[model samples]
Target: MVAPLSAWPWENLGCFKYLLYGPFLAKVLYSRFHDQEASEYSWCLHILVICALRGLIHQIWSSYSNMLFLKRNFRIIEHGVDFKQIDKEWDWDNFIILQALIASMASYMFPFPANLPFWNTKGFIAVLTLHMAVSEPLYYLMHRYVLHGNSFFTHHHSLHHSSPVPQPFTAGLATFSEHLMLAVIIGIPILGASLMGYGSIITIYSYVLIFDFLRCLGHCNVEVVPYQIFKTIPFLRYLLYTPTYHSLHHTEMGTNFCLFMPLFDAIWKTLNGKSWELHKKIRSNLGKSGRVPDFVFLAHVVDVSAALHAPFVFRSFAALPFSPRFFIIPLWPLTLLALLMMWAWSKTFVYSFYKLTGRLHQTWVVPRFGFQYFLPFAREGINKHIEQAILRADKLGIKVISLAALNKNEALNGGGTLFVDKHPNLNVRVVHGNTLTAAVILNDLPKNVEEVFLTGATSKLGRAIALYLCRKRVRVLMLTLSAERFQKIQKEAPVDCQNYLVQVTKYQAAQNCKTWIVGKWITPREQSWAPPGTHFHQFVVPPIFSFRRDCTYGDLAAMRLPDDVQGLGCCEYTMARGVVHACHAGGVVHLLEGWTHHEVGAIDVDRIDLVWNAALKHGLRPVSSSC
Candidate 1:
């Protein structure tokens, strides 16, 4: 029969065992000798033997696990397993042994007895245990109330979440600040117990070391403990540490904060309820049967569409001005070209519109896109021009006339007549008409009517009429569609007539003011003072208009008629100095300064005299004249 299997293996290793046992037994025997030197020597030798045996056992177990996984084709390397990720890799048993050795050596140097007077062993043990209990609770409270509640959590704790699924070693991979905080917490109790002369410090230190080692073991991703046992003895299971439980904490945060006990988390309710659910889901998804959803098909369609149409939509509007006659020819080539140009133009037009309106205005017919530079449009440019012209009239110490034709078709056909109203000063006359020709009738004013403002003349034909008036040497400001259009008209018009045609778009013409801003105190003395809010505040002022010089004493107080005030004729006032100072002093009637003029030195002396006279009649006093 085959020799006993166990005996066969032991017989071959018997000689090697004897070789190790002989030296160990000899040391033990030598420690009991009557000589102090021999006894000390033996004791040192025995300590080394025990440490070596423990290290051997640890290595054997680790190697056995590795080999078992290898046999099962479950290589940790294949799964990206890393040992450095484990936190707190201090060999607790070995550390304790080394500490003991150092302490023993120190005792010899001091010649102190192991059992010193005043150090009661039993009392020391009790005190040490109590210190640990108190320190743990304090640590928990500090973590919950301070670190987690304040901004510290955002800066410090957030770093840990950088890796959601962490390896074992990552547990101790805290920043230096975090490590220092831990050291303080641990040192407080350790130092307190040591200073109190409680039990043997060595034994107390041993317990602390063991607890720290257990914490490290828990963080390690090794499933050595049985799940069945954990289920059966619930209380004992809570006490025992496990890799799965700790791993869950790393993956799903806000859980498992306690290193030695779960009571702290339970009492504070900080334990994450979803930890178990997340762990189960992660594990199930990692299994062979799990499948990732296919989003590639949908993503491809979106990518292709964006690539094909983005450029076309962006370039269409810019081509509009060049191809004004594009719509006349509906052929694909012309149509395509028109669409492309419009796309480019629209980009700039929309941007400028939003800049002025503070609202994004888009049309379905106009393809939306983003680009640099905004071209002025009929809608925005006309309003802006009128506002500027009004301002200019005020600055030039001249009168303004505003005309509105409600019937667009009739105005275009020259069938409507003009409605004229003089400002309170009778210096500015507003002419409202449905037709350009009707507005042109203002040019036939009597010599005394120094300034004539024509409104409702915004079409191409209206601009031509304004140009004609300019040729006639009348200071004519015309509100048009856009700057681009104004420039085009200027290019085509006679040089002598161009200067007369002040191309104030409708937008600029609407902002003109004819009143002087004054304080409440001066109101009783003057009837021409304005208190603000009479003019359109939302209207955008153009660069050419001068609001400060254009605004009269009556406009600031809203005393001037709206029809007399040009809306879009000027730039915004830098500051309402006349009004601000007067308002502060409670004065209603501030001295009126004459309007700002586009051609300051060129303003007709007679026209200025007439404006001053008109303002005087309106109860405005010219206290001083810079002119």
Candidate 2:
């Protein structure tokens, strides 16, 4: 457990934690209405603006580092950040809030008047000189002697070093004491410049932002600085540090203790001898391609808000199970505009990834939303994006790709049949993963169930469930409008079991059945026909609401990923931590089982049980029903 002082006070508030700045915001509004002089409280507003700009800089670096497309080839650490690391660093912006508050209080306490000039060349030179002479050595001595040499400070510093693989935000993940010390190291030079009578607004903004920018750059875990320049000048290497240089400090813990410049380390004889060599080695591999994934789960966005839940948007928020926050309501219009842009120009891109049992798995989003698939004009565009993703995966030697959710909707792409039929020679196995979906739904049913009610009985999952249950001598009341479609599915079962697959067109026909298998969205009126205590087992997208309080409803077919899974930092849709929709798991099982055939088109009834058993064999547990 973390010590009370080690954690931020507002950590648990989530997005609403921004309300800590409410007083400053209220001040800005009050000044605007009262037509107050710009000099009176303008610095207060400037402090808030600078704080926001600092946050934006960190967010940009973080998002850039996490993007597989942009940073795949240059990743310093091959493994990704896990949920544990994300949780530990959830309050990364605490220091920013604290700094802003301190600055606000200092404004009134200090004798300096407001409206310092915009630019001060003498101030910039003075601060830059003082930073090198005073700030650099002060921080180096304090960091090496106190932070690492002393055990008390080391305990607080350990929180920053906890994440071995660093992202930009990792720079700010530290105990409150450590951050307070950092604020002092940064404050001395600015204070010295002011005491020398050269301080100005630009000087303050420039110095602090550069300090934060360099801090973020070192923790980005990507080698962006070229080695050739360092080789040519040699002295420049000590003036600026690379990501790999700082990364070595995290791993080794005793060397490279200088804040940003390594000159102090070189002068003190504490510089790691291999820093330049290692930086060159990592830089040499920058242009090479990343590894090919073994499995890919092709998915699409569900709605505007869910789009913000992507790993790149907000790492801390994405680490938790997805649900819209009250704070996100203000950003709704912006997200909607982003969606329209995606609809007009976006293609498939990698969303997130993880490694399971030495095999690489990734989720690739199709750049379309659920509602857009139902729009008739958007069908062709959606299918085109999916095809491009499939062909890209095949070209990269990916073994299997599972179509998730609406990406494989029967009405859109014929459950991925259109792609396979069009390109027969493709090596990558295309999978709808409905075999596991049917298995999860069927296994959730009561074993003693004599009669079961089924909705969307003619759909792919519904047909497989009806046929598989009929083999067990269970009666299936398949509700469908097309008698012809019902007869076609019944003929596929054994002749002796054909009578067990009965057809019914109305919800009233299943009033006596206590088990309801729903493949389509059903209204409360339709759900009313089920007997009390009925459990609705469903495979529908955006799962139906649990309107019957007296009854139970199972979540969409899903399975908990194996315990050994690594680098999975976000939840799949709204699934509990570590759980993924069954279709995504099916892709994993396909790679684990080494099956060569594509599990596309109508789900094979025979493979329903086979897939379920394989998932269990590999430690993927089925999700239980809940009210």
Candidate 3:
């Protein structure tokens, strides 16, 4: 009995036909051509040779155009335009190599059969032309739907999208699956024609090569053909495609789906309706800028030179001796190492260059008469004036505290107090008891103290302190290098303390005797002030005190948390005076509860099984059951 309808004959037909067409065609062709007719075969040979040459020339020209477009129009430094939108590397080297291997196989293993009726020279050419016309619409449909569809886009099509404005070289740069799909789609019509005795497979192959060349040309950046001619004659327009139309496909995306003609897109309403408007605008802008197309020509030269020389340059390097001299001496290794280092250094250099230029290009800041402040980095004579102000302040018994040394690490070290050990006279203390403690400490300062100097104050902390001090009617002098750096603090600094936190340079503070008259002065590092009510809830515990349920050690000794956690916990709770064990447990409960209740300090409690158990058994989890 015949197999069920589910077991279709064409299930494995593709694979079987793929294996048969190549060898069968070659044998038939060999049988038909006599030994004496080898010379007469020159006609066929010349045609094939001419076709191949034309395809190659077209590819080269297209590639040149694309390179020019990139070099001239590409905005590399702009945030939205250039490298940010595209991947750092093309990353299609493997895909290209695989395609080359497949093309090579297709070239060698497949030859047209002369013995077959479908292999007749003129008949084959006619059928091949018809096949191309039919296949064009299919190609458009596949490009519009399957390639652009969300399901397959990322895996199969996103690689093409990597180059938003692609070059000609990128035309064939697709995933292997995409290439195979193209081969199947393209091969089917030609195969069908050959089976029906309408065309030679060789003619179909020639058409495919020419099609690839034109496709690459369509993507080229240079305008090889005039837009007016193509726009005027609909049938003739189908013969010659333009770069502008194809480029819009890559640039705007999902707009121009047709390859050879705009007919498909026009029929489907996928054509970019404003293409002409955009073209006119682009031309007008280019004209206003006095831009010429010479840059495009120059870019082509560069691309050609790079392509031709790159192989030789790479081979020369590869041929070098693998010795210490080649590897380490005479700056080769040093040069490579320098280049590697240069990758990061170049970014820094570019940033610095732009910053310098920006500063140089900026208009001078004219000071408002009575409230005049020196420029932040005026190296001429501003230092002496600043020093004199500081001396005057010191003479008035105001203690100058500097918090320059308080880094993030030191802040963590001092139980998140953010105090540095640089100042000997500044009484440093960690008064806040919780994670939001950064604010609480400043709020609860002694009322008798005329001025409290906080050295390491971020904008948030500075804002918090300024707000608190302004409420208490205390003078809070906040000294920094630049007013711009502390602009946030200046804006948010309480209106009452607007004049109190008088920003001054170190030199200015040192110069003025009146600055010393202020009860106490603090000079935090530039831009360190934090606004009022700012909190750091997610305070990390030292590794020694952290217990990970997922991790286990060979012995208990190997599994201990960091010693700093123990030291801080003991010092903050166990070693403090008037510290009850119940209060200590309560503090832990508050910390844990804060983690759950607040978004700022939320902790992952799923792994805190032991802590959860202890808190529950000892009634330390806090009474708010909703948490």
Top lDDT hit: 2
Error of 2 at 30 (Å): 5.7
Q: Determine the C-alpha RMSD for candidate 3 after optimal superposition of all C-alphas.
A: 22.4
Off by over 4 Å in 3: 1-59, 66-133, 200-202, 231-235, 238-240, 277-627
Order the numbered candidates by TM-score, best leading: 2, 3, 1
TM-score of each: 0.29, 0.93, 0.36
lDDT of 2 by residue, 1-627 (tens): 565466667767887988888888888878888999876668668888889999988998888788875667677787778899988877788899888887787677552336466777998999999899988999999889877766645567888888968999999998887787888888877777777888888888888899999999999998889889998999999999999899899888889999989999999988998799889888888445578899999989998899988888888778888888987899889889977886777777788899999888998887787798999998998898999999999999999999998989899989999999999999999998889988888888887889999988999989999999999999999999998999999999999999999999899998989899888899999999988999999887768989999899988898899889999898887888889998888888999999999888898898888899999999999877322
lDDT of 1 by residue, 1-627 (tens): 332211112234533533434544564567556455543544345344544544444433333332221211211111222112111222223232333344345444432223333345654565556544765666667655654655656656454444333333234444334444555565455345545555343444444455455545554344445545645776754454455556655665557665555566667786666433433433333443321111000000011122122112211121121222333343445545544664454421111000011111110112221121122243243233333333333343433222221111122212111111111333332222112221212222334322223332344334444444555576555454477766765665578757755654433342342211111122222222222332111111111122333233222211111121211111112212111111111111111222322111111222323443444354433212211
lDDT of 3 at 251: 74
The parts of candidate 1 lying over 4 Å away from their true place are 1-79, 82-128, 144-150, 154-168, 274-627
Instruction: For candidate 3, report its TM-score.
Output: 0.36
Candidate 1 achieves a global lDDT of 0.34
lDDT of all predictions: 0.34, 0.87, 0.38
lDDT of 1 at 45: 53
Candidate 2, lDDT over the whole model: 0.87
What is candidate 3's lDDT per residue for 50-125, written digit by digit as tens?
3345446444653354232123332211111122222222232222333333443543434333333434676566
